[model samples]
Target: MTKRLQLADIGSALIVLFCLVPFYWMIVSALRHPADQFATTPFPLPVSFQNLAAAFAERNGFGRALLNSLIVAGTTTLLTLAIGITTAYVIARVEFRFKNVVLAIIVATSMFPGVTLLIPLLKLFVGLDWINTYQALVLPSLSFGLPLTVFNLTAFFKQLPSELEDAAQVDGCSQWQAFRAVILPLAMPGVFTSGIITFIAAWNEFIIALSLTNDQKMRTAPVITALFTGQYKFDQPFGTQMAAGVAVTVPLVIGALLFQRRIVDGLTAGALK
Candidate 1:
């Protein structure tokens, strides 16, 4: 048993190192002087903030892009969770016609390639004059976000003890009140999991944001980061790009660290049930 435990620890350490090496390289590159960015050394000899400064340079509009991502992603998470909570409650608790079909359809929508919907969505946004607006970004993201939210939350709700709702109702709580008061608290892990996933999806989404928003001012961090070109033509600015990558990655890392347990619980909630 001790030998097995040691092997497992070693394996886990290796896996974590494999995943983190690229991120560490990005940070090292981002902190290296632009002139020394291509040095084979894995560590920055003398750390510099120039790459970070360049990434957030006023002309690059990275700050605005970051704010735009926050607005769109935050709004998408909120809306998806609100609707998902109610929809999941009904699907989990209420018996309705074609219920399995409905759940399957919701899951199926998430499986559709997002790229295929871009052109039609772009045209629709154009018609509505929503181009370069928050709504344009949020609406298309919902297509993917809502389905997963519903699927996860539904599974979580199903795993919850029905006695909680029954007890709430016996205390004169309406169905809505029972759900809002009794069910929601118990389902928070699932909600956090779904919300974090939705937020990350919206934050990292590129093609749709690129296709919909023509203006740089409305661009999200992922879109702007992709378009990052250095001061001169054909200049890749690897250091600056690395800085942008680190900037874009920090919030996601922080969120995952904070809610990892909840995410794990949410994913495994209904597995036994």
Candidate 2:
């Protein structure tokens, strides 16, 4: 048993290390002096803040891009969760005509390649004169996020005991109140997990943001990072790009660390009961 546990631990460690390698390299490169940005050293020597400074330089419009990402992604996450939770709860707990068909359609929507929606969405949003607006970014993201959110949250809601809802209703709570009060709180882990996925997907989304928003002020971080250029036209600005990468990733890391406890507790709280 001890041997098996050790092997499992080692496997987990290796997987984590593999995932963190690029992140470590990005940080090291971001901290490196522009002159030594290409050095093969494992550690950054003569560290400089130039890359970090360049990342937020006026020409890059990256700071604004960061705000754009926050607005768009945050809006997308909230809207996705609100609609998804309700939709998932109904699908999971209620009996309705063609319920299976509805579930199938939701899954099928997610499976559709997002790229396929590009031209049609662009034309639709253009007709609405919504180009370069938050809605332009958000609505398309919802189309993709809702299906994943609904499917996952539906499964999570199913696993939760229906007796809880029944008990809530018996106590005179309306169906909506029962769901909002009892079930939602208990499903925090699944909600958080799905929200994180939605946020990251919307945040990292590039092609759609690029294709939809023509203005730099409306562009997302990933798009702005791609637009990063050096002091000279010929320069690659690799260090600055690394710095931007670190800047973009740090918030997500911090957020995960902060919420990881809640997620773990939610998962274990059920088993304990």
Candidate 3:
């Protein structure tokens, strides 16, 4: 057993290192100059700040794109948490017909390819005259982020003690009052976990944002990155692209670092109980 356990630990460490190699490569590539990318022996180092500087100042307007991304992601995170928390509570605590079926449906939605819905969604946005607007961006984000949030939160909520609600009610609290005062507070870990997931999902989203927004002013970071790879330029501005990649990843890293404890707690809260 000890030998087997040692082998398993080694395997896990190898897997983690394999997963991290691409990220490390990206950091090295982002620092190297475009010319150096093709050099006989390219080492990982920033060729020049010029690449990042130029990428930031390029016509794609990553600054505005980043700001728009922040708005869209921030809004989606808040909305998903508010709606998902309630839906999760209902699903976890309420005994009703077709409950398992409903849960299955929610999980199934996450399995569908989001790309398949793009054209249809774009047409819907056009009918609503919402193309190129923030509404188009926000609605699509909510739809994609909600199902996962609800599923995760429902699992977490199932682990909570029913005695808390009963005690709150015994104190003359109504259902809403009990939920607001008791359930909501205790569900913070789940809430923050969901919010972090939603935020990261929105931040890294590429396809929907690319399809929905045309104006550079409305573009997101990923879409703007696409601008670098065009017909005329066989080679993208490698350094700039790397820097932009770094920029995009920073917020997600910070968010995860800040709420990592909640993430672990939320994901594990009900799994064993």
Q: What are the C-alpha RMSDs, in order, of all predicted structures?
A: 1.4, 2.4, 2.2
Candidate 2: Cα lDDT at 68: 96
Off by over 4 Å in 1: none
When 1 and 2 are scored with lDDT, the better candidate is 1
Against the hidden reference, what TM-scores do the models get?
Answer: 0.95, 0.91, 0.91
Candidate 3: tens digits of C-alpha lDDT, residues 77-186: 88888888888899999999999899889878777787987999999998998888888888888876889889988987888888999999999999899999998888
- Worst lDDT run of 10 residues, candidate 1, spans 264-273
Candidate 3, residue 140: the lDDT equals: 81
Between candidates 1 and 3, the lDDT winner: 1
- Please give, for residues 11-60, the per-residue lDDT of candidate 2 as tens digits: 99999999999999999999999999889999998888999999999989
Error of 3 at 249 (Å): 1.1
lDDT winner: 1
Q: What would the TM-score be for candidate 3 when compared with the true structure? A: 0.91
lDDT of 1 by residue, 1-273 (tens): 999999999999999999999999999999999999899897899989999999999999999999999999999999998888788889999998999999999889888788999889988988999999999999889988899989888888888889998999999999889988888888887888888899999999999999998899999999999899878848888898899999999879998998899889887885657
Q: By descending lDDT, how would the candidates be arranged?
A: 1, 2, 3
Best by TM-score: 1
Q: Candidate 1: global Cα-lDDT?
A: 0.90
